[model samples]
Target: MAELRPDSANRHRTRVKIVECAARLLRAQGAGAVTTRAVAQAAGMQAPTIYRFFEDKEALLDAVAEHVFATYVAGKSLADPSGDPVADLRAGWDTHIGFGLANAALFGLFADPGRGARSAATTAGLDVLRARVHRVAAAGRLRVPERRAVELLHAAGTGTVLTLLSVPPEHRDPGLADAMYDAVMRAVLTDVPTLPADDATAAAVAFRAVAPDLTVLSDAERALLSEWLGRAGTGGDRGQRDA
Candidate 1:
Protein backbone atom coordinates (compact mmCIF):
# COMPACT_ATOMS: atom_id res chain seq x y z
CA MET A 1 0.00 0.00 0.00
CA ALA A 2 1.23 3.54 -0.71
CA GLU A 3 0.53 4.59 2.87
CA LEU A 4 2.76 1.79 4.20
CA ARG A 5 5.93 3.42 2.83
CA PRO A 6 5.32 6.72 4.67
CA ASP A 7 4.54 4.83 7.89
CA SER A 8 7.71 2.76 7.61
CA ALA A 9 9.85 5.83 6.93
CA ASN A 10 8.38 7.67 9.91
CA ARG A 11 8.98 4.65 12.17
CA HIS A 12 12.58 4.32 11.08
CA ARG A 13 13.21 8.02 11.60
CA THR A 14 11.68 7.99 15.06
CA ARG A 15 13.69 4.91 16.01
CA VAL A 16 16.92 6.61 14.93
CA LYS A 17 15.95 9.76 16.82
CA ILE A 18 15.34 7.77 19.98
CA VAL A 19 18.68 5.95 19.62
CA GLU A 20 20.57 9.22 19.18
CA CYS A 21 18.92 10.78 22.21
CA ALA A 22 19.75 7.74 24.32
CA ALA A 23 23.33 7.77 23.05
CA ARG A 24 23.78 11.37 24.10
CA LEU A 25 22.39 10.63 27.55
CA LEU A 26 24.62 7.56 27.85
CA ARG A 27 27.77 9.50 26.92
CA ALA A 28 26.96 12.38 29.24
CA GLN A 29 25.86 10.48 32.34
CA GLY A 30 26.72 6.78 31.91
CA ALA A 31 24.41 3.74 31.60
CA GLY A 32 22.36 4.60 34.69
CA ALA A 33 21.12 7.75 32.96
CA VAL A 34 19.49 5.81 30.10
CA THR A 35 16.04 5.09 31.51
CA THR A 36 13.01 4.91 29.19
CA ARG A 37 11.50 8.13 30.55
CA ALA A 38 14.81 9.98 30.22
CA VAL A 39 15.31 8.83 26.66
CA ALA A 40 11.72 9.66 25.76
CA GLN A 41 12.10 13.14 27.31
CA ALA A 42 15.38 13.67 25.45
CA ALA A 43 13.74 12.58 22.20
CA GLY A 44 10.71 14.90 22.91
CA MET A 45 8.31 11.95 22.92
CA GLN A 46 6.04 10.28 25.50
CA ALA A 47 7.53 7.40 27.53
CA PRO A 48 5.17 4.73 26.16
CA THR A 49 6.28 5.48 22.55
CA ILE A 50 9.73 4.15 23.39
CA TYR A 51 8.23 0.72 24.01
CA ARG A 52 6.85 0.53 20.48
CA PHE A 53 10.31 0.93 18.97
CA PHE A 54 12.35 -1.19 21.40
CA GLU A 55 11.02 -4.02 23.54
CA ASP A 56 12.88 -2.77 26.63
CA LYS A 57 15.77 -0.65 27.88
CA GLU A 58 18.33 -3.34 27.10
CA ALA A 59 17.22 -3.59 23.47
CA LEU A 60 17.23 0.21 23.20
CA LEU A 61 20.78 0.39 24.54
CA ASP A 62 21.84 -2.19 21.96
CA ALA A 63 20.49 0.05 19.21
CA VAL A 64 22.34 3.00 20.70
CA ALA A 65 25.57 0.96 20.63
CA GLU A 66 25.08 0.01 16.97
CA HIS A 67 24.42 3.66 16.15
CA VAL A 68 27.59 4.80 17.88
CA PHE A 69 29.73 2.05 16.34
CA ALA A 70 28.30 2.76 12.87
CA THR A 71 29.29 6.41 13.21
CA TYR A 72 32.79 5.45 14.40
CA VAL A 73 33.28 3.06 11.48
CA ALA A 74 32.00 5.70 9.07
CA GLY A 75 34.65 8.16 10.24
CA LYS A 76 37.48 5.61 10.00
CA SER A 77 39.65 5.55 6.89
CA LEU A 78 39.47 1.97 5.73
CA ALA A 79 42.99 0.77 5.07
CA ASP A 80 44.02 -0.82 1.79
CA PRO A 81 45.68 -4.18 2.31
CA SER A 82 49.22 -3.72 0.93
CA GLY A 83 50.03 -7.43 0.54
CA ASP A 84 51.11 -7.44 4.19
CA PRO A 85 48.26 -8.92 6.17
CA VAL A 86 50.07 -8.58 9.50
CA ALA A 87 50.51 -4.85 8.97
CA ASP A 88 46.88 -4.66 7.96
CA LEU A 89 45.82 -6.35 11.19
CA ARG A 90 47.93 -3.92 13.19
CA ALA A 91 46.26 -0.94 11.54
CA GLY A 92 42.85 -2.40 12.31
CA TRP A 93 43.91 -2.82 15.91
CA ASP A 94 44.81 0.84 16.27
CA THR A 95 41.50 1.93 14.82
CA HIS A 96 39.64 -0.45 17.17
CA ILE A 97 41.48 0.88 20.22
CA GLY A 98 40.86 4.45 19.18
CA PHE A 99 37.16 3.78 18.78
CA GLY A 100 36.93 2.07 22.16
CA LEU A 101 38.73 4.91 23.95
CA ALA A 102 36.68 7.62 22.33
CA ASN A 103 33.47 5.92 23.41
CA ALA A 104 34.13 4.73 26.93
CA ALA A 105 30.57 4.48 28.21
CA LEU A 106 29.42 2.55 25.17
CA PHE A 107 32.56 0.43 25.37
CA GLY A 108 31.86 -0.27 29.03
CA LEU A 109 28.39 -1.52 28.19
CA PHE A 110 29.72 -3.85 25.52
CA ALA A 111 32.67 -4.94 27.64
CA ASP A 112 30.42 -6.66 30.13
CA PRO A 113 30.09 -10.24 28.90
CA GLY A 114 26.36 -10.49 29.62
CA ARG A 115 25.54 -7.11 28.04
CA GLY A 116 27.95 -7.69 25.14
CA ALA A 117 26.28 -10.97 24.28
CA ARG A 118 23.08 -8.96 23.66
CA SER A 119 24.75 -6.39 21.40
CA ALA A 120 24.54 -6.59 17.62
CA ALA A 121 27.36 -4.04 17.31
CA THR A 122 29.72 -6.25 19.32
CA THR A 123 28.87 -9.20 17.09
CA ALA A 124 29.47 -7.14 13.94
CA GLY A 125 32.84 -5.96 15.25
CA LEU A 126 33.86 -9.57 15.93
CA ASP A 127 32.86 -10.47 12.38
CA VAL A 128 35.22 -7.79 11.08
CA LEU A 129 37.94 -9.11 13.39
CA ARG A 130 37.40 -12.64 12.06
CA ALA A 131 37.88 -11.44 8.49
CA ARG A 132 41.12 -9.70 9.40
CA VAL A 133 42.39 -12.79 11.24
CA HIS A 134 41.50 -14.98 8.26
CA ARG A 135 43.44 -12.66 5.95
CA VAL A 136 46.55 -13.20 8.07
CA ALA A 137 46.00 -16.94 8.11
CA ALA A 138 45.57 -17.03 4.33
CA ALA A 139 48.76 -15.00 3.83
CA GLY A 140 50.73 -17.51 5.96
CA ARG A 141 51.83 -14.82 8.41
CA LEU A 142 49.79 -16.42 11.16
CA ARG A 143 51.66 -19.20 12.96
CA VAL A 144 48.49 -20.23 14.77
CA PRO A 145 45.17 -21.54 13.46
CA GLU A 146 42.77 -18.82 12.31
CA ARG A 147 40.42 -19.62 15.20
CA ARG A 148 43.22 -19.30 17.74
CA ALA A 149 44.47 -16.06 16.20
CA VAL A 150 40.99 -14.58 16.30
CA GLU A 151 40.46 -15.61 19.91
CA LEU A 152 43.81 -14.18 20.99
CA LEU A 153 43.28 -10.88 19.23
CA HIS A 154 39.75 -10.46 20.54
CA ALA A 155 40.74 -11.32 24.07
CA ALA A 156 43.82 -9.10 24.04
CA GLY A 157 42.16 -6.15 22.41
CA THR A 158 39.14 -6.24 24.69
CA GLY A 159 41.32 -6.70 27.73
CA THR A 160 43.54 -3.79 26.70
CA VAL A 161 40.56 -1.52 26.16
CA LEU A 162 39.02 -2.48 29.51
CA THR A 163 42.35 -1.95 31.27
CA LEU A 164 42.89 1.43 29.68
CA LEU A 165 39.37 2.52 30.54
CA SER A 166 39.76 1.39 34.15
CA VAL A 167 42.38 4.05 34.70
CA PRO A 168 41.90 7.81 34.40
CA PRO A 169 43.27 9.63 31.35
CA GLU A 170 46.30 11.25 33.02
CA HIS A 171 47.40 8.06 34.75
CA ARG A 172 46.88 5.62 31.83
CA ASP A 173 50.13 4.26 30.40
CA PRO A 174 50.80 5.62 26.95
CA GLY A 175 52.45 2.46 25.63
CA LEU A 176 50.25 -0.12 27.33
CA ALA A 177 47.92 -0.73 24.40
CA ASP A 178 50.73 -1.07 21.88
CA ALA A 179 52.68 -3.29 24.26
CA MET A 180 49.70 -5.59 24.75
CA TYR A 181 49.13 -5.73 20.99
CA ASP A 182 52.77 -6.68 20.37
CA ALA A 183 52.60 -9.39 23.02
CA VAL A 184 49.54 -10.95 21.41
CA MET A 185 51.04 -10.53 17.95
CA ARG A 186 54.15 -12.43 19.00
CA ALA A 187 52.00 -15.32 20.07
CA VAL A 188 49.83 -15.32 16.94
CA LEU A 189 52.15 -14.55 14.01
CA THR A 190 55.59 -15.44 12.67
CA ASP A 191 58.10 -13.22 10.87
CA VAL A 192 57.24 -12.67 7.23
CA PRO A 193 59.44 -14.82 5.01
CA THR A 194 61.77 -13.24 2.46
CA LEU A 195 63.20 -16.52 1.24
CA PRO A 196 62.45 -20.23 1.40
CA ALA A 197 63.25 -21.78 4.79
CA ASP A 198 62.38 -24.91 6.74
CA ASP A 199 59.70 -23.20 8.88
CA ALA A 200 57.39 -25.95 10.06
CA THR A 201 54.90 -23.37 11.35
CA ALA A 202 54.79 -21.65 7.99
CA ALA A 203 54.43 -24.99 6.21
CA ALA A 204 51.54 -25.99 8.43
CA VAL A 205 49.82 -22.61 8.05
CA ALA A 206 50.11 -22.79 4.28
CA PHE A 207 48.95 -26.40 4.15
CA ARG A 208 45.96 -25.87 6.44
CA ALA A 209 44.23 -23.82 3.75
CA VAL A 210 44.28 -26.69 1.28
CA ALA A 211 43.72 -29.51 3.74
CA PRO A 212 39.95 -29.55 3.32
CA ASP A 213 40.22 -29.78 -0.48
CA LEU A 214 42.43 -32.88 -0.41
CA THR A 215 39.90 -35.40 -1.71
CA VAL A 216 42.31 -38.28 -1.11
CA LEU A 217 41.54 -38.10 2.60
CA SER A 218 38.27 -39.26 4.11
CA ASP A 219 36.31 -36.95 6.46
CA ALA A 220 37.96 -38.55 9.47
CA GLU A 221 41.43 -38.38 7.93
CA ARG A 222 40.90 -34.75 6.89
CA ALA A 223 39.83 -33.86 10.42
CA LEU A 224 42.91 -35.57 11.82
CA LEU A 225 45.14 -33.69 9.39
CA SER A 226 43.51 -30.42 10.42
CA GLU A 227 44.16 -31.13 14.11
CA TRP A 228 47.79 -32.01 13.37
CA LEU A 229 48.29 -28.90 11.24
CA GLY A 230 46.76 -26.63 13.86
CA ARG A 231 49.19 -27.90 16.51
CA ALA A 232 52.08 -27.80 14.05
CA GLY A 233 51.37 -24.19 13.21
CA THR A 234 51.15 -23.43 16.92
CA GLY A 235 54.70 -24.82 17.43
CA GLY A 236 53.34 -27.49 19.76
CA ASP A 237 52.81 -31.24 19.62
CA ARG A 238 49.23 -32.34 18.92
CA GLY A 239 49.50 -35.41 21.13
CA GLN A 240 51.26 -33.76 24.08
CA ARG A 241 49.26 -33.15 27.24
CA ASP A 242 49.83 -29.88 29.07
CA ALA A 243 50.86 -30.06 32.73
Candidate 2:
Protein backbone atom coordinates (compact mmCIF):
# COMPACT_ATOMS: atom_id res chain seq x y z
CA MET A 1 0.00 0.00 0.00
CA ALA A 2 1.12 3.54 -0.63
CA GLU A 3 2.19 5.60 2.33
CA LEU A 4 -0.52 7.98 3.60
CA ARG A 5 0.03 11.69 3.05
CA PRO A 6 -0.28 13.79 6.20
CA ASP A 7 -2.20 16.52 4.43
CA SER A 8 -4.69 14.05 2.97
CA ALA A 9 -5.19 12.39 6.32
CA ASN A 10 -5.74 15.71 8.05
CA ARG A 11 -8.24 16.80 5.43
CA HIS A 12 -10.18 13.57 5.77
CA ARG A 13 -10.36 13.85 9.55
CA THR A 14 -11.53 17.45 9.36
CA ARG A 15 -14.29 16.59 6.88
CA VAL A 16 -15.51 13.76 9.08
CA LYS A 17 -15.55 16.03 12.10
CA ILE A 18 -17.61 18.67 10.31
CA VAL A 19 -20.17 16.13 9.14
CA GLU A 20 -20.50 14.59 12.60
CA CYS A 21 -21.01 18.01 14.15
CA ALA A 22 -23.58 18.99 11.56
CA ALA A 23 -25.48 15.74 12.03
CA ARG A 24 -25.58 16.12 15.80
CA LEU A 25 -26.90 19.65 15.60
CA LEU A 26 -29.47 18.68 12.99
CA ARG A 27 -30.71 15.85 15.16
CA ALA A 28 -30.96 17.82 18.37
CA GLN A 29 -32.46 21.04 17.09
CA GLY A 30 -33.39 20.32 13.46
CA ALA A 31 -31.50 21.31 10.31
CA GLY A 32 -31.95 25.03 10.79
CA ALA A 33 -29.71 25.06 13.86
CA VAL A 34 -26.60 23.71 12.10
CA THR A 35 -24.19 26.54 11.45
CA THR A 36 -20.52 26.43 10.52
CA ARG A 37 -19.50 27.94 13.82
CA ALA A 38 -21.88 25.73 15.75
CA VAL A 39 -20.62 22.62 14.02
CA ALA A 40 -16.99 23.63 14.55
CA GLN A 41 -17.65 24.24 18.22
CA ALA A 42 -19.41 20.91 18.50
CA ALA A 43 -16.47 19.14 16.85
CA GLY A 44 -13.88 20.97 18.93
CA MET A 45 -12.39 22.58 15.84
CA GLN A 46 -12.22 26.16 14.63
CA ALA A 47 -14.87 27.46 12.20
CA PRO A 48 -12.31 28.07 9.43
CA THR A 49 -11.29 24.42 9.57
CA ILE A 50 -14.68 23.46 8.07
CA TYR A 51 -13.97 25.56 4.97
CA ARG A 52 -10.95 23.44 4.14
CA PHE A 53 -13.32 20.58 3.36
CA PHE A 54 -16.57 22.29 2.34
CA GLU A 55 -16.72 25.51 0.35
CA ASP A 56 -19.67 26.96 2.27
CA LYS A 57 -22.58 26.09 4.50
CA GLU A 58 -24.69 24.93 1.57
CA ALA A 59 -22.04 22.52 0.37
CA LEU A 60 -21.51 21.13 3.85
CA LEU A 61 -25.22 20.68 4.36
CA ASP A 62 -25.45 18.98 0.97
CA ALA A 63 -22.69 16.57 1.86
CA VAL A 64 -24.37 15.62 5.12
CA ALA A 65 -27.73 15.13 3.41
CA GLU A 66 -26.07 12.93 0.80
CA HIS A 67 -24.49 10.75 3.46
CA VAL A 68 -27.72 10.28 5.37
CA PHE A 69 -29.81 9.66 2.24
CA ALA A 70 -27.34 7.14 0.87
CA THR A 71 -27.73 5.14 4.04
CA TYR A 72 -31.50 5.35 3.64
CA VAL A 73 -31.42 4.21 -0.01
CA ALA A 74 -28.97 1.36 0.55
CA GLY A 75 -31.16 -0.13 3.22
CA LYS A 76 -33.98 -0.27 0.66
CA SER A 77 -32.11 -1.04 -2.55
CA LEU A 78 -33.48 -3.94 -4.54
CA ALA A 79 -31.73 -7.28 -4.02
CA ASP A 80 -33.08 -9.88 -6.46
CA PRO A 81 -33.67 -7.67 -9.56
CA SER A 82 -35.93 -10.48 -10.70
CA GLY A 83 -37.75 -8.16 -13.16
CA ASP A 84 -40.82 -8.08 -10.95
CA PRO A 85 -41.94 -4.46 -11.09
CA VAL A 86 -44.61 -4.52 -8.36
CA ALA A 87 -42.37 -6.30 -5.89
CA ASP A 88 -39.56 -3.89 -6.60
CA LEU A 89 -41.84 -0.91 -6.05
CA ARG A 90 -43.19 -2.34 -2.79
CA ALA A 91 -39.68 -3.02 -1.56
CA GLY A 92 -38.75 0.56 -2.32
CA TRP A 93 -41.81 1.89 -0.51
CA ASP A 94 -41.20 -0.26 2.53
CA THR A 95 -37.61 0.85 2.66
CA HIS A 96 -38.74 4.46 2.39
CA ILE A 97 -41.20 4.14 5.26
CA GLY A 98 -38.72 2.32 7.45
CA PHE A 99 -35.99 4.87 6.88
CA GLY A 100 -38.26 7.89 7.26
CA LEU A 101 -39.64 6.72 10.61
CA ALA A 102 -36.27 5.65 11.94
CA ASN A 103 -34.43 8.75 10.77
CA ALA A 104 -37.05 11.45 10.97
CA ALA A 105 -34.59 14.27 11.49
CA LEU A 106 -32.54 13.33 8.46
CA PHE A 107 -35.65 12.69 6.42
CA GLY A 108 -37.19 16.04 7.21
CA LEU A 109 -33.93 17.79 6.55
CA PHE A 110 -33.83 16.51 2.99
CA ALA A 111 -37.52 17.09 2.35
CA ASP A 112 -37.45 20.73 3.43
CA PRO A 113 -38.22 23.01 0.47
CA GLY A 114 -35.51 25.57 1.04
CA ARG A 115 -32.55 23.35 0.17
CA GLY A 116 -32.96 24.32 -3.52
CA ALA A 117 -30.64 22.25 -5.77
CA ARG A 118 -28.03 21.11 -3.26
CA SER A 119 -30.26 18.42 -1.77
CA ALA A 120 -28.78 15.46 -3.58
CA ALA A 121 -30.72 13.00 -1.46
CA THR A 122 -34.10 14.30 -2.52
CA THR A 123 -32.99 14.55 -6.15
CA ALA A 124 -31.55 11.05 -6.28
CA GLY A 125 -34.51 9.52 -4.49
CA LEU A 126 -36.87 11.03 -7.03
CA ASP A 127 -34.61 9.93 -9.86
CA VAL A 128 -34.75 6.39 -8.55
CA LEU A 129 -38.54 6.50 -8.31
CA ARG A 130 -38.90 7.97 -11.80
CA ALA A 131 -36.69 5.28 -13.25
CA ARG A 132 -38.91 2.67 -11.69
CA VAL A 133 -41.97 4.28 -13.15
CA HIS A 134 -40.36 4.38 -16.58
CA ARG A 135 -39.60 0.68 -16.47
CA VAL A 136 -43.07 -0.25 -15.25
CA ALA A 137 -44.63 1.90 -17.93
CA ALA A 138 -42.52 0.15 -20.53
CA ALA A 139 -43.78 -3.23 -19.38
CA GLY A 140 -47.41 -2.05 -19.43
CA ARG A 141 -47.87 -2.14 -15.66
CA LEU A 142 -48.51 1.62 -15.38
CA ARG A 143 -49.65 4.57 -17.43
CA VAL A 144 -47.54 7.46 -18.63
CA PRO A 145 -48.53 11.10 -18.15
CA GLU A 146 -49.20 13.97 -20.55
CA ARG A 147 -47.00 15.97 -18.24
CA ARG A 148 -43.88 14.59 -16.56
CA ALA A 149 -44.69 12.01 -13.94
CA VAL A 150 -41.62 12.86 -11.92
CA GLU A 151 -42.71 16.42 -11.24
CA LEU A 152 -46.21 15.35 -10.30
CA LEU A 153 -44.97 12.58 -8.07
CA HIS A 154 -42.45 14.85 -6.40
CA ALA A 155 -45.07 17.36 -5.39
CA ALA A 156 -47.52 14.73 -4.24
CA GLY A 157 -45.05 12.46 -2.45
CA THR A 158 -43.15 15.22 -0.73
CA GLY A 159 -46.30 16.64 0.73
CA THR A 160 -47.45 13.16 1.75
CA VAL A 161 -44.20 12.11 3.44
CA LEU A 162 -43.89 15.38 5.30
CA THR A 163 -47.47 15.09 6.44
CA LEU A 164 -47.19 11.43 7.38
CA LEU A 165 -44.12 11.92 9.56
CA SER A 166 -45.75 14.73 11.52
CA VAL A 167 -48.75 12.78 12.80
CA PRO A 168 -49.11 12.32 16.55
CA PRO A 169 -48.48 8.88 18.04
CA GLU A 170 -52.09 8.25 19.01
CA HIS A 171 -53.23 9.15 15.49
CA ARG A 172 -50.50 7.19 13.65
CA ASP A 173 -51.05 3.86 11.91
CA PRO A 174 -48.49 2.07 9.75
CA GLY A 175 -51.03 -0.04 7.90
CA LEU A 176 -53.02 3.04 6.96
CA ALA A 177 -49.93 4.88 5.80
CA ASP A 178 -48.94 2.06 3.47
CA ALA A 179 -52.46 1.72 2.17
CA MET A 180 -52.73 5.43 1.44
CA TYR A 181 -49.44 5.50 -0.36
CA ASP A 182 -50.47 2.51 -2.40
CA ALA A 183 -53.77 4.07 -3.21
CA VAL A 184 -52.19 7.30 -4.36
CA MET A 185 -49.69 5.51 -6.54
CA ARG A 186 -52.39 3.37 -8.04
CA ALA A 187 -54.59 6.34 -8.78
CA VAL A 188 -51.82 8.31 -10.45
CA LEU A 189 -50.66 5.35 -12.47
CA THR A 190 -54.17 4.68 -13.71
CA ASP A 191 -55.20 8.23 -14.49
CA VAL A 192 -52.13 9.13 -16.52
CA PRO A 193 -51.71 7.36 -19.83
CA THR A 194 -48.28 6.03 -20.85
CA LEU A 195 -46.25 7.65 -23.61
CA PRO A 196 -45.22 5.92 -26.79
CA ALA A 197 -41.67 4.60 -26.93
CA ASP A 198 -40.08 7.77 -28.27
CA ASP A 199 -42.13 10.04 -26.03
CA ALA A 200 -41.39 7.98 -22.94
CA THR A 201 -37.66 8.11 -23.62
CA ALA A 202 -37.85 11.83 -24.24
CA ALA A 203 -39.78 12.48 -21.09
CA ALA A 204 -37.29 10.48 -19.09
CA VAL A 205 -34.42 12.52 -20.48
CA ALA A 206 -36.21 15.77 -19.72
CA PHE A 207 -36.80 14.75 -16.12
CA ARG A 208 -33.20 13.73 -15.73
CA ALA A 209 -32.15 17.20 -16.77
CA VAL A 210 -34.65 18.79 -14.41
CA ALA A 211 -33.03 17.35 -11.28
CA PRO A 212 -34.24 19.16 -8.15
CA ASP A 213 -31.65 21.04 -6.13
CA LEU A 214 -31.83 19.04 -2.90
CA THR A 215 -29.72 21.11 -0.53
CA VAL A 216 -31.07 21.80 2.94
CA LEU A 217 -31.58 25.46 3.72
CA SER A 218 -29.53 27.48 6.18
CA ASP A 219 -30.22 26.65 9.84
CA ALA A 220 -32.65 29.55 10.14
CA GLU A 221 -34.59 28.60 7.01
CA ARG A 222 -34.84 24.96 8.01
CA ALA A 223 -36.33 25.91 11.36
CA LEU A 224 -39.08 27.87 9.67
CA LEU A 225 -39.81 25.18 7.05
CA SER A 226 -39.82 22.44 9.64
CA GLU A 227 -42.28 24.36 11.77
CA TRP A 228 -44.61 24.87 8.83
CA LEU A 229 -44.32 21.26 7.68
CA GLY A 230 -44.93 20.07 11.23
CA ARG A 231 -48.16 22.02 11.37
CA ALA A 232 -49.23 21.04 7.84
CA GLY A 233 -48.37 17.45 8.62
CA THR A 234 -50.84 17.30 11.48
CA GLY A 235 -53.86 18.57 9.56
CA GLY A 236 -54.63 15.38 7.67
CA ASP A 237 -56.66 12.32 8.64
CA ARG A 238 -55.81 10.67 5.34
CA GLY A 239 -53.16 7.91 5.22
CA GLN A 240 -50.68 9.08 7.84
CA ARG A 241 -53.22 9.01 10.67
CA ASP A 242 -50.60 7.13 12.70
CA ALA A 243 -47.43 8.34 11.00
Q: What is the TM-score of each candidate against the true structure?
A: 0.81, 0.62
lDDT, candidates in the order shown: 0.80, 0.61
Once fitted onto the true fold, the runs of candidate 1 whose alpha carbons sit more than 4 angstroms away are: 1-4, 70-79, 194-197, 210-228, 234-243
Clashing pairs in 1: none
lDDT of 1: 0.80
Best candidate, lDDT-wise? 1
- Model 1 over residues 85-158: C-alpha lDDT tens digits? 77778988998898788888998877878877766666777777777777776666766667777778888888
Tell me, by TM-score, which candidate is best.
1
Task: Tell how far residue 141 is off in model 2, in angstroms.
Answer: 0.9
Worst 10 residues of 1 by lDDT: 234-243
